[model samples]
Target: MPNAELPQAKRQKMANKTIGTHNGTFHCDEALATFVLKQTDEYSDADVVRSRDPAVLDTCDIVVDVGAVYDAEKKRFDHHQRGFTDVHYGLEIIAKRLGTALDDPKVQYVWLKLYRDFIEAIDAIDNGISQYDSDVPARYRSRTDLSSRVATLNPRWNEPTGAQILDARFQDASALTGKEFFQALDYYRDSWLPAADLVKDLITSSKQSADPSGRILVFEQFAPWKEHLFEIEADENVPSVEPNQAIYVLYPDEAGGNWRVQAVPVSPSSFESRKSLPEAWRGIRDDELSKLTGIDGCIFVHASGFIGGNKTKEGALSMAKKALEL
Candidate 1:
């Protein structure tokens, strides 16, 4: 066989680019910002130079989190100016670098997803914004967040903080943030985006079926539906009023040959449901559940009524339908 079958390391790209940022203890924002720049074709293999010297920064192709400038035409992205208000400063640059128009639906989805999930926190922390409205004590201390973990790569407060030491640590910080950034990007682009389309199809099909309420959705197959459900409903101008909003979702359970009916939450990230399975059916199971709900092939309704199981898709749909009537 040819040597082509052998596993090999990723080939390094030609070094024809330069990315500049301030030289000092690195933060998650600049570390991630630099990683985002390196992902673009123009800077994919760029050399990263950390410095605050105007002369040194001037020679670089792009500067971020430094230079006290915010000119995109000149490739400067700094947020430290007197009145900079663009929290999406980093995203704008990334989109521009990748030649993606902000108005494109897919671009908009991924941009918002990335910002909401991680980048927003980085921007907040860097800008000295509080995470909570009040100064209440946190329930738990989290040293494992990306920002906190990135900060660990910097030299200890008691340790040496030389330029060489800090720069080397910055490389490590960039790698740390880069790994998480691309993973999230890949997930949002490949998995989350596709789920939206799947949910949209399910939503459209649900209306044409026997159900007149249009509040119960039955998926042909399982997909992450929550995030897309609310958005799709709003896009379709479905009123948030009862019988118009989605109350439950029915889909086949992968583990068993049974089916599941899940209550749609009040919001995507919320635990509160718009309408739970049914108070009477809560925690009931087997034949008793079927007897109470007058639905056959019942398995169980969860204690919280968020979900219930049935032996078949029809049974699950029947459960969702009955819940709607109640």
Candidate 2:
């Protein structure tokens, strides 16, 4: 009674559903798309078939990154076809049909959010869409993103083009893309989203508790605040929160065991601070900083005047308050 002798019904039940993609030179978009589809119950045990043959692809229940068809109802997801858009129409359909809670911070929500950051890049690359405007300086161009990395995994021009060789390379590409996708998904769900809530709460509280200027935010604990700060301020839903009021933030520095007063940037990613510390304190440290600032436990201020440190929370708060007056 070997396993081969099992009944046809039992064998069919145990067999994996088929997922089809192009055979040669796989890119990040398809590799990640396949992995994403596999995560769902409908394709949890899917067997990936890498081929360009119409006959082979037709047998697969779902096809992605190939076949030149963009029909969601027909289970086709190719962006190479003319008139194909970057929207994840198939995913949106699945989300709606399943009644996924868009409000909840779950996998579906994370998936949708991540599409903007990760999948959109792949779609843009596959569709030859430039991320930045055409007028952007050549020096400012970004090189070697996830798509480029995945493209590199394909067999080099000199490498053998045999079926086995191509298959092996495709497997390698799939694994690399899958790993990155899972890591990014977990990071957004576990770290980025939670930190955002905390940052928003701090921003609201700061507005209420700060002096009339409403410029300084005091954090109960240090966290990644830059991006969240800008997002919370610009959020249209929070009508009471003024987008331009915050100029500085105070938090504890874990490594140095000191408190820090940091200038908020004009924009989330900008290097220019909204309001710098006093020019006299720039690059000054310890005793010199204390004497100039007339504040005890003063550590040092950065040469750029973006940040300064103090031995106590009170000292850091004082530094920000004094800088505000200056």
Question: Which candidate should be chosen as best, given TM-score against the real structure?
Answer: 1
Model 2, span 156-182: residue lDDT tens:
888768778877777777788878876
Q: Quantify all predictions' global Cα lDDT against the true fold.
A: 0.82, 0.80
The TM-score, computed over Cα atoms with residue i paired to residue i, of candidate 1 is 0.84
TM per model? 0.84, 0.83
**Total backbone collisions for each predicted model:** 0, 0
Candidate 1 local Cα displacement, residue 224, angstroms: 1.1
Give me the runs in candidate 1 sitting further than 4 Å from their true place. 1-17, 87-104, 157-161, 236-244
Writing each residue's lDDT as its tens digit, candidate 1 over 68-123 gives: 89877788878776655554344554455345775666777677778888788887
